[model samples]
Target: MRYIISYVSTVNPDLSNTDIAKLMDHVNVHNNTIGLTGILIYSEGNFFQVLEGEEEIVKRMFERIKKDSRHYNIIKMLDKEMNDHSFSEYHSSFTVISDHYSQTELQEFLNKEKDYNPEHYKSILYLTQKFMKLL
Candidate 1:
């Protein structure tokens, strides 16, 4: 089965921007071999990411991510099986939300998830669509 998982995590203060870039590069390479696709957003020392792939593999990946020392306070925001891949365009696209979108827009965008849309994804989809075009 195909699955997608989204989570928000606190970035470890000790790591620099270069370290995060290197980590994402490593993740992208590993994700490619495993058939995963998604986007990662980092801003204000927090990471919001969506990963999609085979169920077991994605679960395992999330587990490994949970244990990675580079980030903490992992909070899963979405988990579901999907008929089609929503993020097939990239193996692991990275976006710094602050770079392309204003903090006000991002905050306003994030504050309005009272319910999920018909497709089961919520506000994250909107954020993904806007950022995906930038890459």
Candidate 2:
């Protein structure tokens, strides 16, 4: 079965912008190599991410994520088996919502995703808005 997990986490205060960029680079490369697809948004010291892939692989990745020291206060908003992969449009993606304009653009892009589950889409939008408001 395929699985999806979405979560928001507080970034480690000690990390610099360069560190975050390196982290995003690693994520994109590793996820592509492992055949996972998802989107990640970071803003205002928080990260909102959705990862989808094989059930066991996704679960294992989440476990590893829980152990990563770059972030804390992790709150998983969604996790379940999924019959469809809504984020396959990209192998893996990352973005930083720095301002209202970026947030609006991202929201518009997400809204245009026809394959995304409405419930999941709404949940993501809520989390994104929450993070953006903190910026």
Candidate 3:
């Protein structure tokens, strides 16, 4: 079965651009090796990432992520088995959405129940598009 594992974290103050690049490289290698797909969103000092892959592979990746030193305050926002992979194109994609959402939008997102947050995903997608425009 496919699974979706999402997490939120903050980058460590000591992390450097080189460190971030290396970590991304490591993630890319692992994702390619295991056929994983995902997107990572960073905004306002927080990061939200969603990983989709075989249940075992995704879980293993999450375990490694938990021990990674690039970030802290890690929280598993969502981890559930799914019937299909939602994102199948990229091994992983990165976005910076420092201005994607307003305060009201963020509040509405946070108030949503776990199972009723399609809008939140939509917002993330919108942010990704915005980030892409800057590329």
Leading candidate by lDDT: 2
Question: Alpha-carbon error at 112 in model 3, in Å?
Answer: 15
TM-scores, each model vs. reference: 0.71, 0.75, 0.65
- Candidate 2 backbone overlaps, count: 0
Q: Residue by residue across 1-135, what tens digits does model 1's lDDT show?
A: 678788878899998988878877887677877788766766567777878789998899999999999899998877877665655433333455433333334343334332333443454655454544332
Ranking by TM-score: 2, 1, 3
The collision pairs in model 2 are none
Selected candidate, larger lDDT, 1 vs 3? 1
Clashes of each: 0, 0, 0
Q: Give the lowest summed-lDDT range of ten residues in model 1.
A: 108-117
Pairing residues by index, what is the TM-score of model 1? 0.71
- Candidate 2 to native Cα RMSD, angstroms: 4.7
TM-score of 2: 0.75
* Number of the candidate with higher TM-score, 2 or 3: 2
Cα error of candidate 1 at position 6, Å: 0.5
- Which residue ranges in model 1 land beyond 4 Å of their true spot? 89-135
Q: Is candidate 1 or candidate 3 better by TM-score?
A: 1
lDDT of each: 0.66, 0.72, 0.61
Instruction: Tell me the TM-score of model 3.
Output: 0.65
